[model samples]
Target: MVVVGHIFWLSDFGRFAVFGFYILSGYLMTYIMHTSYGYSSLGRKKFATNRFLRLYPAFWAAILCSIVITLFWGSSSNGFILPTNLAAIIGNTTMIFPHWMPSQIEPRLSPATWALTVELFFYVAIALGISKTLKRTYIWISLSVVFIVLSYVMNLYWHARYFSIPAGSLPFSLGALIFFLSKQKSVRYIPEAILASPIKLFFTSFCIAIVTSIAISQSLSFWLMEIIFYFCMAINFLLVLSLAKQNTFVNGLSTKLDKKIGDFSYPFYLLHYQAAAIASVISLGKVASLKENFSLISCMLTFLILFIMSLCVIKLIDKPVEKLRQTIKAK
Candidate 1:
């Protein structure tokens, strides 16, 4: 994934994957919150507890490891520049430094924690009852569109630092809309069936064409490209969800892998960049050089090492934290 990011500058397909995550989040959150568990069952306290368990433990572990690696083994433009200020270290440790105030220390540690900042904001928004008020499918969809537009506007005009809301968020809203639509007993499941149908082959092909065209075209602005990418992502997500429902074989395979990887994905994504940065230092500038053919090989090795490290992190930190949360909630 890191290799793709480095190689294909125009291939922002990973961002599209983030969009798929958003739609899925919306669907799953809505189903769990509104359908399986009553809205009254989830107050702000419960919401905060859930979000904290889901995020903070693994995050803090990754941050600490990254800081240690940087301090000891990391390379510098000149020699090692020790992180001097207590404020900077505290900011990175808390994950509040990049979100509230910009800092030079951001590039040094886990840069991907920026996405966690967006995610934390989303959690706060949902917990505060903002998501609860968006009852209708249309309203949720409209709000998503509005947010995207506002994000673009902020990016274009105001130079808002965090204008590009992670794509994972939109999926959550989309999922909410799906959940709402599913509840209306009168609403036929035919649309979903069609989405799930073999006819999706055509739609998938068309989406591919559109994506290719946009990638080739230099005239489209970054925001416009983002819009196109999200639209394609939504369609692709619908197709994938539909197919998953209808195809038992596919469903079975997906279910197994999803169970294994779903929760761990966040930790993997967050920690992978840190792993890459450290690998680059250890490689002695060999990892980052476009001229070196071995850089690709180094990156692949780095990704594998990071994946193993993330799995260990998940087992050691995340699982224990989760168990502790469950115990507290049970009490």
Candidate 2:
């Protein structure tokens, strides 16, 4: 979904996918912290280290790709000499950037990485308070609501209404609620079909979400502001919870496939723009968006390069990091 959106601009799937990804991240991180890394000081230390190991190598590789692309086959309108620009570069290199930093000042080499910036903040929050999560879950949800409300009231951009830290944390909080939900034997209103066919339900909601996003973006209808965000978010929560709770052969197989694909997703996401840029530079004479010169052949080649580079990064970086992460899990 993210690849298609970024590489082709076919829909708002990339933006919406981040909303869903945060839920998955929050749920998975909460579970692992609960089960494997207890909130002891040593446990927190190990968790932090493991997260750094998981995120940085692939991020750095992507950053390097961005820098090289800028230096050689691309243009850098933002000069490297300004102190602010250099600071942004340093921040990007370290995978540390202030969430409040304006988009123009801290230019994301790949725009998708803005999510990672927001995500990093949450990682620290998780380490510090994942144990208290059930107790403070509503607080997180409330903050998300506040953020979304503020964004809408302020007439901020579409991304701001949903995926900024406060608004974005809604999905994460909702995702974490699944952890609480699974604990209660009495909370049993879930349909068997949803649990049995999580992907089907998810895709149906996902399509609705994409269309709703377009409606919201274009202001095709006014009711979207009041309704669509919550609807899409609730649907994602149910889908993720269904995936988490179900134990059947079909879901088991899907889980295996998810795990396999998830291993590639991070590097693949980070490399998507670079792949498209290279493809565009070849076929269209310069780096450009989907709006520039829509070419099926270029998009196809971008996917090919993106997939190949994603595989290479996994083989070179993520696979090794996984071994180290497993050692932490073993403890």
User: Which one is best on TM-score?
Assistant: 2
Candidate 2 residue 241 C-alpha distance from true site, Å: 0.3
True-vs-predicted CA distance for residue 218, candidate 1, Å: 6.8
Instruction: State the C-alpha lDDT per candidate.
Output: 0.56, 0.72
Candidate 1, 1-331: lDDT as tens digits: 3233433233343455545555566666555554333455444566567767777778777767766665666543311234468876775666655533232344435655655555566655555444564455566567666765776666654223223443345565566666555444433545645554534543573556446555745565755665566566657556545543443424346776766776667777767656655566566653343223346666676677678878888788887888877765554
TM-score of each: 0.73, 0.87
lDDT of 2 by residue, 1-331 (tens): 7787655755465656778888888887787778778789988888888988998889989878877877676553322122246777777777665666323335666556767877887777877874356778778877777877777788887656554566557777777778777676545777665666677668877787678656766755554543765676677777788767753425346766867787888988788888878887788776666545778898788888888989999999888888998897677
What is the overall TM-score of model 2 with all chains considered together?
A: 0.87
Among these predicted structures, which one has the highest lDDT? Answer: 2
lDDT of 2 at 8: 71
